[model samples]
Target: MALPENYDYFTREQWRNFHGKNQLNTVTGDELAQIAALNDRISLTDVQEIYVPLRHLIHVYLRRYHQLVEDKADFRGETVAPTPFLIGISGSVAVGKSTTARLLQLLLSRSLPNQKVQLITTDGFLYPNAELNRRGIMARKGFPESYDMEHLLTFLDQVKSYQPGIKVPRYSHQVYDVLPDSYDVIDRPDILIVEGINVLQLPTNQQIYVSDYFDFSIYVDAKAALVEEWYLQRFGVLLDTALQDPLNYYYPYAIGDRQAAFTMARQVWQDVNLKNLREYILPTRNRADLILHKTEHHVIDKIGLRKY
Candidate 1:
């Protein structure tokens, strides 16, 4: 594939050389197991080559960001503390974005020992299933309109302004809904990673976009067909786990004919996920500061760094 304008694209071999060796020693095998998403694979070598370089770049951004913060404070003639540096990670469903987000969070936390780092998903900002059903858009759950963008924007505003103890609604994959009365408290952190498919989306209804608060952003890229395969593979794993749990949202499908269950999964990938990716998510790809392009089996083959 041809590279986009304003981006310096590099093959994995070339990108790996940007960061020196021996960085993989920090991430252990057990940590890799914890960070990897279901049906997603990531090795320590990937960390040393791809993520380590990525982390190094983030540090470069952070240093510049801190200098600007001090410069702005000096212009106002008042000493001001630094606000949270927000990183937004976005991509299509089943594209291993969650894995990337979690991995980056861990890496940043370890490297920036003095700075506090926190990670949250925009899934928490999604409208409850009941609300979606009432709105007659339950079938289009992952669509841009299904999110409570106003609420999300408000939360991001608070975080960027250094608000403490802000609560984020909790979302449950097992129930496939936003859990009522459950929340995660985000104390003001030095750095925040917001990950979701809609992170980089521009909702027409909102005056400002979610990406407006981001100091840096990354978009995970992969072919639609490859994503579909990974989606189905993940669905199968979900079914296997749901088989023993009656409360699982997938329990009904897990108990039914396996072939029919897979058929439904494929249909969802085509009618919902694929449609959202093509129309909304992919269109925002060029807006990212960085892009990680993946090949077969979730291997990142190339990296794109925006020049401007």
Candidate 2:
């Protein structure tokens, strides 16, 4: 399928060739497995060919961002605080966004020797289970409205303004709930990767969007059918691991009939995750500065770069 008109589309080989003469650092097989999400496929060659070039692009963007800040300071003849470059990664739940965000964070941090790059997933911004129950959005957990949009916007605004001691709530996948008052502090960073399924969603009723603070954004793309397969595969893995613990939210599925568990996974994917992707996530693909289109086996076969 053709990409949107505004994009300069390139096949995988073509995109790989765009990496300049510099021999960029590559992730080893062990490291790839460490950062890779369960059920997704990514090799060192993929890192060298795809993520290295992407790191170079982000490096250029970071440099230009600092330069622009300096230019503005000079124009005003006043000192201004250095700004942290925020990058947003958005995609469907099972599309490997966590892996992508972690890859970019690692690559960017290593490539830039003098700066600190931090990665955060906005799952932290989700409302607590009790709140969701009260609001009657438990079934719509990953939907845009299910998130604490107001708090998310405030967090981003503070980050953009270079605020310190900013604490973000953490969500526990094992329990399938937000850990109340448990927080991750984001100190001032040179670059921050803010990733989530709804990161690139359009502006909501609020005057500001979570993406308004983003200087650059990425959308991971793949067929919904393939993503559903991945979602099921991941659920199975969790049953083997996370569900083994009685405290886990999925323990019921783990001890229940295996076929029934599979059935439930499919139902949740169709009713919740897939619905959110179709109504909210996929529509934001074109808004991304870059799109990574994945094919079978989670291989990124094409890249689409926006011309403007």
Q: What are the root-mean-square deviations of the candidates from the true structure over C-alphas?
A: 1.2, 1.4
> Each candidate: what lDDT?
0.92, 0.87
| TM-score of each candidate structure, all chains considered together | 0.98, 0.97
Off by over 4 Å in 2: none
Per-residue lDDT of 1-308 in model 1, one digit per residue for the tens?
24468799999999998864545547888999999999998998899999998998999999999999999999999897859999999999999999999999999998988999999999998999999999999999989999999899989999988999999999999999999999998899999999999988887677687888999999999999999999999999999999999999999999999999999999999999999999999988888999999999999999999999
Name the weakest run of 10 consecutive residues (lDDT summed) in model 2. 19-28
Off by over 4 Å in 1: 1-3, 20-24
Q: After superposition, how far is residue 33 of candidate 1 from its true place, in Å?
A: 0.5
**Candidate 2 lDDT (Cα, 0 to 1):** 0.87
lDDT of 2 by residue, 1-308 (tens): 24677999898898888754265665667887999998888988888888888888877787888889999999999897879999999999989999999988888777776888888898998889999999998889989888888888888888888899899998899889889779899998889999999888754687766677888899999989999989999999989885559999888889889999899889999899988888998888888999999999999999999988
Best by lDDT: 1
